[model samples]
Target: MHPTLAYKWQCVFIQVGKFANEVFLLLPPYLPILAGSLSLELQVLNLAAAIVLIAGKAFWLKSGRITPTDFLATLDAYIGGGTANQVRVAILEAFKDGIGGIGTDEWKEAFTQLVLDNQMQTAEPLEDREHP
Candidate 1:
C-alpha cells in the first residue's frame, strides 16, 4: 500500500476505536437508569464490564499486531471487483476537491460524479408521462 493510503486506513481505524469507546461510555447499565432510577450494584457491574471490554480492545489495537498493509489487503478483498482501484481513485479525487469527510449529500454528489465520469449509464432519464 502507498504511504498515503496506509495513513488513511490508520486514520479510519483510529476513528473506529474512538467511536467504540464513545458508545461504551454513553450507554447506561439498564433501561431504568434512563429514568434516573439507579441500581448501584448493577451500574457498577455494567461500568466495569464496559471498561474491561474497551480496554482490551484498545490494547489489541495498539499492540501493532495488524499492519496497514494487512488492513488494506482485507479492505481491497472486501471491496472486490476491478472497480476497486477506480473507486479509490474517485474517492481520493473527491477529497482533493475539498469534499468534507462527513455527510451523505457530498458523498452522493461525489458518487454521481464518479458514475458520470465512468460513463456507466446508457439509459436516458425517465419523463413524467402525465406532464408530457
Candidate 2:
C-alpha cells in the first residue's frame, strides 16, 4: 500500500477506536439510571393496573345487579364512612344473626323488605316525617 493511504487508513482506525472508547466509557454511568427508570416505569404500570382493576370491580358491582354481595359493595362504595357505615354495620349484624337459618329465597325477601322500608321513609314529607 502507498504510505499516504496507509496513514489515512491508520487515522480512520484511530478515530473509530476513540469513538468506541467514548461510548463504552459513557455507558457505565447511564446504564444504572436507565435500569432504574425502567424499574420505576414498571412499578407505575403495576399500580395503574391495580387501580383500574379496583375501579372496574366497583363499577361492575354497581351495574344494577341484585345479588346481596353486589348490593353491599355498592352501598359501601357509595355511602363510605360515618353514619352510613354505622347503618351498614347494623344491617350486616342484623342479617348475620339469622343468616345461617335463612335460605336464598328468604334473603331476597329480606332485601326487598329493606328496600321497601327505605322507600317509605324517603317518600314521606318533612311535616309528616316530623310526626313519625
Candidate 3:
C-alpha cells in the first residue's frame, strides 16, 4: 500500500476507536432506566446495543472503504511475520465482539510491541530503524 493512503487509514482507525469508546461510555447511563421502565432485562438492552454496534461495523466492512488486502497490508506495516497474522486474528475476534470492543490501545500496543520485539525479522537492522 502507498504510505500516504496507509497513513490516512491509520488515522481513520484511530478516530473509529475514539468514537467506539465514546459510544460505550454514553450508553450506560440511559440503558438501565430505559430497559427497566420497559419491563425488559438489562441483558436485553446490552444485546441491543451490541447489535447496533456490530451492525455499524458490518456496514463499514461492507462499504468497501478498506479492502481486506489493504487492511492486511496496513497491519503488516505495523507488525510483521507470524505475529502480524496473530494480530489479524485478534482483529477478527474484536469484530465479533462489536464496534465498541474493537481498536483499543491494547491492540495498538500489541502491534507496537511486535514491531519492537521482532525488528530483527524485518529487512533492516534494529539500529537502522526509527525508535519510538
Error of 3 at 44 (Å): 6.5
Tens-place lDDT digits, model 2, residues 2-116: 9999999999898757754653453343234223323453333322222233234444544542333332333233232232333334345446444443447876576545433
TM-score of 2: 0.24
The reply for model 2, stretches above 4 Å from the true place, is: 32-132
Runs in model 3 with CA error above 4 Å? 33-132
Candidate 3 has a TM-score of: 0.30
Q: TM-score per candidate, in order? A: 0.24, 0.24, 0.30
Model 2 residue 39 CA deviation in Å? 16
Q: Write the per-residue lDDT of candidate 3 for residues 1-132, one digit (tens) a residue.
A: 999999999999997787556545544543443233232332453334333333333344446453323332322333323433443344344333433432578655543443344322333212222212
Model 1: lDDT equals: 0.41
Runs with alpha carbons beyond 4 Å of true place in candidate 1? 31-132
